[model samples]
Target chain A: MVNREFTVENDPRILFGKRLAKIRKELGWTQEGLAIESGIARSYLSGIERGKRNIALINIYKLAQTLKIPVKELVDI
Target chain B: MVNREFTVENDPRILFGKRLAKIRKELGWTQEGLAIESGIARSYLSGIERGKRNIALINIYKLAQTLKIPVKELVDI
Candidate 1:
């Protein structure tokens, strides 16, 4: 048995995912809506929310811009 | 020319690089010192400080941890 999926709850990626989900939900945004508005692929956005993507800085910036928040707010964790 | 390198002065990667350099320099740490301490490659760290890399979240967190600062401080730019 191989444990290829190494994501843990305390992982930064996981924490980032959870944070993103909470903020998006608070904004009443569906994953689909955010993807469309942020010009990210829906599947990619889903992956990001699931902590499966090692997202880049530019993408993070784009997401923050789309949500009208500071990059600091999105990544403060 | 294809202009493959699209980096500009105002690019987030550039801003991130400048911010990282400023913080690291203020700490009186050399790039090689920070890279070794943070477990990042010196060359890669150099690129990051030059705004040539679109750094990932985990790496950003690692750099901040090495600097004893909040992740937000490294990324608030």
Candidate 2:
């Protein structure tokens, strides 16, 4: 049986996507705004937000910088 | 002109490599120890430490877990 909690807790992509969407919404920025600020394509950001992409460390740093949050805020579940 | 400081500051790989090396040493763990604990190949860990690899989020998460540091500790410059 799959340990759902463990799965949820350990999946960085899901954690990142959820945090990214929440933070973006909290900041009232659209995907386009965030993408432009982070220097990633909007479609790519969309994929990341949906947990469909395996984000690179550089992009994670860019998003953290652009969102003005510690990268911890996004990754520490 | 190349903003050397800015380049150094924003390069996550370099920052990560330095921090990883520092933390690993602080914990008295060798690269082999860290690689085995983090489930990454020793060769790949070496590559990452040299900043020649674009580490993925999963690997960063794995390293953070094995190191007992927040993922931010790895990615934040």
Q: What is the TM-score of chain B alone in each candidate?
A: 0.88, 0.81
The lDDT values for all models are 0.86, 0.80
What are the chain A TM-scores for all the models, listed individually? 0.87, 0.82
True contacts kept of each: 0.95, 0.84
lDDT tens digits by residue: candidate 2, A1-77: 23232366567788889889999999999999999988899999998987777798778878888989877676655
Candidate 1 chain A lowest-lDDT run of ten: A1-10
DockQ of 2: 0.64
Off by over 4 Å in 1: A1-9, B1-9
Could you give me the TM-score of model 2 versus the true structure? 0.84
| TM match of model 1 to true structure | 0.89
Interface RMSD of each: 0.7, 1.9
TM-score of each: 0.89, 0.84
Instruction: Give candidate 1's error at residue B65 in angstroms.
Output: 0.9
Root-mean-square deviation of every model:
3.1, 4.1
